[model samples]
Target: LHNMRTIQHLPREKQMQKATETMELYAPLAHRFGLFSIKSELEDLCFKVIDPNSYKFIARKLREKKEAREAFIEEFMDPIDEELGKQGFTFEMKGRPKHIYSIFRKMQRQQKPFEEIYDLFAIRIILEEPHTKEDCWRVYSIITDWYTPIPKRFRDFISVPKANGYQSLHTTVITKKGRKVEVQIRTRHMDDIAEKGVAAHWKYKEGKEGGSETLEKFVHWVRDVLDNPRPDAATEFVKDFQLNLYQDEIYVFTPDGELRTLPQGATPIDFAFDIHSEIGERAIAAKVNGKMAPLRQKLDIGDQVEIITGNKINLNPDWINDVVTHKAKSRIRQYIKQKERQKAEEGREIWEKRAKRANIEISEQDLTRIAQKLKFDSTQDLFYDIGKGSFDVNELYDVVKQFTSKGRIDDKEDEDKPAPVTEEEIQETYINAARSISDDKALVINGELTNVKYSYANCCNPIPGDDVMGFISRTGDVKVHRSNCKNIHHLIQTDGERIVDVSWAKNIDSKFLGAVKVIGEDRVGMINDITDVLSKSLETNMKSINVSSDSGMFEGILTVYVDDIDHLGRIINKLQKVGGVKSVFRYE
Candidate 1:
């Protein structure tokens, strides 16, 4: 369907859109299935329709040189054909013409012109399967004996077939005429698999029409993408579908020396996830080639990766950035969202308990009122903010106080009663207050201090690593702020005694939301590239991405989850390297 040229009869706009989809979708699918002939044809047809001038120019060049190229191929094959027959092998030799898209890609990649392109065609040797390996090597020996083989251009796929089951012995040798010609040696069975891909494998396997369980896994993976419920369903499906299409597999080894196959760019985190969800969740670090490496370190063809798991299951949100596989990404996202939902629930409980202690009944009506007072779009948002320490609990109490006076009277009576509170009593009160809400500590200082209800200041967005101080508010809750925040001076001068020392708990592994601004020259696909870079970093989720372009310049604001300032810095540095990106800075 992609290779069809009849779409030209349709309207130009429709033709171009359909052509783009075919190239982005069908071409990669063909490549993944090892349908190289079809893949090349699809690419050429799409390229012709997409960029007719370049296609015509390259086609014309090939046409002008067709006769001489065929003659040269015959000259290159005759001696080898005779020698192979003399060596007691039954083989068929044929000329393989290079596809126009393949030539165009080479020119684009090498930054060369059409006239400088060499090896416009190849020679294929198909042999009987009974003695396939021996005969293929025998043919290789004959060819090398006749011509000088390029050491770097040799590939022995027979010993290591590709992930798509493509097996061929490929070599590029210099002929007597001092011109390069590629040679492919394979059996008839291998040729069938190479052309028909999964279909041929199913036919030969004598299994169900679909294929083996292994092949079914691949089919199911595709179905998973198509079934993924996303807002931009088609676009996301195509993006993920194409992502899996052109991958070259890399085989890595586990600690037990068991071979594990992963996509070429997969990292240790991906490897851990492939092993098991538990292993991936507990993976704290990894050692590649017996040396400590970052989780994002790319694995090579045969590197041995040893995952170091922690006792507690604490996955960094950033692992999504380093992982390339759909499974890893999906699992990580699921885990993070689950944690977020749990946190939101915890926050809801905190609100309910606080309201109860304040002698206020938090009915649905009260929640709606409080949400409106806090400018929250919904009660869930209000709870999430309270849970994430983004909302000041004192303000919430103040708003809810207006709805009832039952808890206010108890507080007033307690205040009026002169009670001598001892140090031990105060400590017990704090512990009881902390225990009433959640086991998770609300605030941790130099020591494990609890019962300190605090909300993060929006002015500084103080994360765990930041130098922070807490300010006691009217309702006894604390409002945390960065020590160096601009608003801290007024607080320091006016209420220095209320400032409390605070630090993140040693075991706190939660993520904090941060905002960043990216400035770059405006160009097509710039936003996609920028988001791709972000997606490959640690636990970085683009909560929102707003891009504005003017006068060929683009500026984007991205709000994402980050572990700390250091995590944000790593993300910024990565964004800086994206094409056309001029600068990346944290938005205060």
Candidate 2:
């Protein structure tokens, strides 16, 4: 405590790690042990360490006028208690103090001072026992009687306990004082269950009669990580289990009365995955609340989810981004990788068969060595490149043929051909590659062949999987452009003979460089500060960064190399965590 000061500083990575460990770990553990008070305290401590400025600012504001804060809580609780009493809920209602850490986060995110952060405080409602499940509904109905329910804000976890085995009804209301406060309604059993989390289920069964076996079964699933074999296999299990332990859940249902518990904002895909991994894998579409919706559709409380599956293979990698649950996302990534590996292996086999048909004899070692030199890890990857038509087959054949024959190879082959010496020859070669409909080099846009003419568009850095089109050039060659590229619209009137159709390959290898401009209020070490955050927080390499400041505002442009769209998302999340970042987004 002596070392604690009015101001403290630590590397942002340390703060993130501390947050992941404390708030995401020990706080949930304390809750599992029925230590409600301790769990809240732990969370507050974590917030304080992670975002000190906001925490300190809020503390000072609340402490400045103790009576004002007390009056706020009283005004916050009056109507809630009146509604609970009128509904005959045997209950206890009270307000919990706002933790320093939480206040700090609110201040930082909202860019407000301590005095403006009022929602940090919350009111809790703990109810007495009800002999039947209907009694739980009775409590819910009672609370809604006095307060105008925010349609999307109500959560009914009583029917289906959360992945972490937590169950409760949570809703928020605007008090007479125009202050918004959260109200948590749960029976005595639920109160105990909520406070203790998974342990409440275990203790209820092992130490008391009339405990729930259903909850016990769920607890066993929660502990599957401990019993699982490989660390990789259980990483998701443990991560999802821990991260979701104290989450806010919504109750969704199936037509068969089977209940599905989901984190707030979960989609149909998440529900399907939660039900079973295969179900999620095959799920192409779904009906939420009996209305057909896209797989990305969000599920709400009392939503009846019906998944649609098809015999055709349509498990797309893009689905990974749409899923909300950690379990769902992890499973999607796993399946996509598995499918890619299988394709690569099949491609390798096909390439091997093609080599055999071509009378080319090469050992697996020869193929593996050549593949490694070309940035591949295995023969399958080499074959995958071959199957995807990325590598020149004629070149690959010569390389392999040479490897098997002690470097004695044909000197007259096109593999060693010199580049065209004249512009006319280059133009003719380009025309042949473009105009030859049977050639793989011809730009086929969405499977349609057109007159050869097109050049690569500059804007948006169009890559594979992106929608694209070809523009005709006066020189009788096509210029390829993303369909949405801003420059494409201006070039549509070019020579018709040069306008050929274009499309992206099924797989892409090139890395697209993206830039982001971060603007915020300036402070000491602000430039070095952002650099440290980017270097440490992000996974990909940062190619270049430029920072400048004048008139109290600091701004920087960060150029990062991304493996793909998914990696870009993680980088965006990291940038959003930087201090004083007024805005962080794509540069162009």
Candidate 3:
């Protein structure tokens, strides 16, 4: 339901998007539930909005054909009327033109021009209450005797009503003038049920005996569709749902003679899934009509299907394209996703092993950059490729080494031209410029006073982009403490209310002092290599660097300027890859 007032408030693009989502979801659901009126109206509105040119073309074609169609329908129904009158059948007949969207679908389905399609309307013959379905069949025989009925075009839904309780006799006959016309025969009660679906089912069958069983089966079908797990993709789900539940049905059977109804074009694999998920997963082959057949063979009406199973899951992802049922598709999608996840994990382990062997210590942020540079949608995609053997891990290692190689990039740019810097360094430069406006830009304090002095706690030396909490001290100052600081454990427990939720501001620029301990073999130029990696490679300004040696082992702690946690991590990674470096750890 599109409220004009509410829709007017949205931008044109957003309105279009909402219409797409509705068409992709609710419209197919309406059709599946036998709500023909609602489904047609919904399709009409969505078609106009989604493709106005096509809608206009179909509407114009329908309008142009209306008068001629009426004449043809009249000529076709006259002989049937005379025959029914002679047979003394109480019936109501009318020529119902097809809906606009329906005609368009017919044209597409037949792959023909609009004028070439002759069966544009159906003449309905609704018998009165006294005339039961048996009489309707007799009437159908009389009509077919007068006209040449196409054997393939006849359906006896009156014998076995549709899952949604629609009962009718449908036939397409060719007249002497070589014009084709469609006809429908049903009782008045069946007509009502066909139009109004469940509502009329309960109304006409208030105390009826046979209808209770049909209604129970109909209810069960609905529950089966709804109660199962929903598919992840909405568009795929809607298309598959329509194929499974709304389209023409084929009645197949098991070897035991039990009947089953599946969508037209359903494969034997779909029959396997309809029986049980376990059977579908384990199905290896199939037998149709007491003869061995391929599992992908499409089933037909009255075809007996038997599934041959194996001990292990014999499912293939390619079967997703062969089956038409939603349950089968959903199960196949789950298996595909599970396999991809396994491959992705394997890829990650391979990458980590290669990284360790190459002495390449890197951050996730840098890995994400390499993933983006490789034109992957996400790091997970990159890893999946690696696990599948499509991507070379050494290629990723080369990218990481270049990323930490003094902020250098190996793209096709002039040697003197400025290479594209990483997002972190760019954000740092931008934040340095933006923070010049205000001193309190480093930490945003809600409802803070003008004289509220802000200071970084010495215990953790919280920096920009560090997770922190603000505590109001007795000196009327706001002190920022790192979220993981051991010193704040007592403060959070004793004076917890004084601790307020705090986060780093994006514009924060001021540097906080951080310290890291690095241990390596005591060798010549060990301290120089560490200092050079910090001050020159990563561009970190060191406040102090101290080292002490015992025999051939040495450990050193360096206090340095840090803009954020990520910056500190990059520093540690750079130091860990230095020559003779055994380990590097940052201390709070």
Candidate 4:
């Protein structure tokens, strides 16, 4: 539902986070257990949001060649159809191109254009019950006899099944017409287990002979993935797990003669993590087959690896690039992140002391601007520099004072740029009085602290995310305006005494009015599509949708109740993706 982009109740930030989790963890997990059907669907759905342009390109290319590809597949399978019929083989044949995401990845790996991909097509041949393992081999022999088999392209999983117990005879062969095609031959029972993954495995588990080894391997593989607890961020997790999904495996041994399977090119760090999380974190040195070798050395088949541990945890950040498994990389990154956070906390304490001693109070918005001017991507990074002694705290105190003394922002570039949905930490505590806010609910704070009272100026109607200034009125209430608003600037220069420091409260419990304008080619169902996106995707409530159409062109103003500027921005972005909608922006 979230991937469909219809679960709009989730904020854009949350949606992005969910999409990343699906891409990095869930989809690949499905693939690991041979749930290709579910895996491919999940990939395509998440791909729509993660990289829309690439998804559209692949989908469009597939559609354009659909008819031709179908004809070619029919022509290619005709000979096999007749041969199988003559041999009285009871089989079901299916011809299909690979999934959209797999093809895109293939293009990326091979560094080739979409048109140049030859092995995009595949055929699956499934035989009925009573078909023995020899029958599968006979089918493979028949196919190879018909076409030239590509070396290293054949996998006889029937003989040595995967950890998931997926058994099939896979081969890529060149047809008489000079086209490459992948082929899979399996029995009905094997196909069932392959399609259903763990579910089918257990279904056939009862009274099944010699299934214990395969089940143990399956359990171990799953345990290996769960070795690392979920981390703060998923970037490293995704990078490592993708290798598990596609890369070949190598079998290694421990000192106790226990065999471990790892992704090809996996290092000692990966091996240690596979054995146990403790050994991976406290790993000091490793002996590969009783010989001291660098941890970065790639393990080979049948090599015995012994990891050395110590009392102290010796995790290296540089090891992030050295390990191929997700567990090792995730643990290393978590360590670095935890250390950085500690430094940032220490820096925050230092800043609070300096600010309190100097009698200076700067808004979170102003601090962010100050951080950017000092070439920091985020305020946390700036403070991190301070904590590590790389940056001077007194210098920051001076910067904050300068910003607070300035009545308003004078930089035109800063005012014109859109306020991002950035997360920030404010030194001051905010009051939970959102229900007392006025109709045009712009966030307000820093007005005598506890008895804070403010309303948005109708002229600009600045929302929570927009950089704003508060002007004290004769009525003892603050009137907030966008810092760039001409009304606020005039008052700042003429009666500067009323210009007071104001920033958005950390939380918003009230809704504000925002107007969005969209223009596009007019067509049937276009209005419905736009409305569904606004109302359903983010669960945003609308006051009214005023629209006009002429000469097959559509223009509309979406008047909606939004929590903040960031919420409104999310709505506009979603509107921009509607099929007939070409332009979407906030209408001031």
Root mean square deviation (Cα) for candidate 1:
22.1
- What is the C-alpha lDDT profile of model 1 across 371-449, one tens digit per residue? 8656787777787788899987778887678656542322222233467877445534544453455444467643556
Model 4 per-residue lDDT tens digits across residues 1-588: 345445345543233445556766678788888887778887877666444556777889889999999998888778888888888899999898888888988876865557778888789999987786789998888888888999889877886676677889999999877888999999887888787777776665666635555766788777766555655455456566677776777778899987677888889988988888888888889999899988888998679999988898878889888887767777787889889989998988889898999888887787888888788988899889988999999988877776677755445666565554322211121123322433344444544343456778988767777666667675556677766456765565455555555667766787888888888998999988988997789898889988999999988888888998779879977987899777776665
lDDT of model 2 at position 259:
74
Ranking by TM-score: 3, 1, 2, 4
Q: Which stretches of candidate 4 lie over 4 Å from their true place?
A: 1-26, 45-90, 107-115, 132-135, 156-165, 209-251, 255-258, 287-291, 300-314, 334-588
lDDT of 3 by residue, 272-327 (tens): 98888899999999999999999899999889999999999988999988988877
lDDT of 1 at 3: 31
At residue 337, give the lDDT of candidate 2. Answer: 61
Q: How well does candidate 3 score on lDDT at residue 14?
A: 40
Instruction: Give candidate 1's whole-model lDDT.
Output: 0.74
> What do the candidate models score in CA lDDT, each in turn?
0.74, 0.63, 0.76, 0.76
Q: Pick out the ten consecutive residues of candidate 3 with the lowest summed lDDT.
A: 427-436
Positional deviation of 80 in candidate 3, in angstroms? 3.6
Task: Compute each candidate's TM-score over C-alphas.
Answer: 0.59, 0.53, 0.61, 0.53
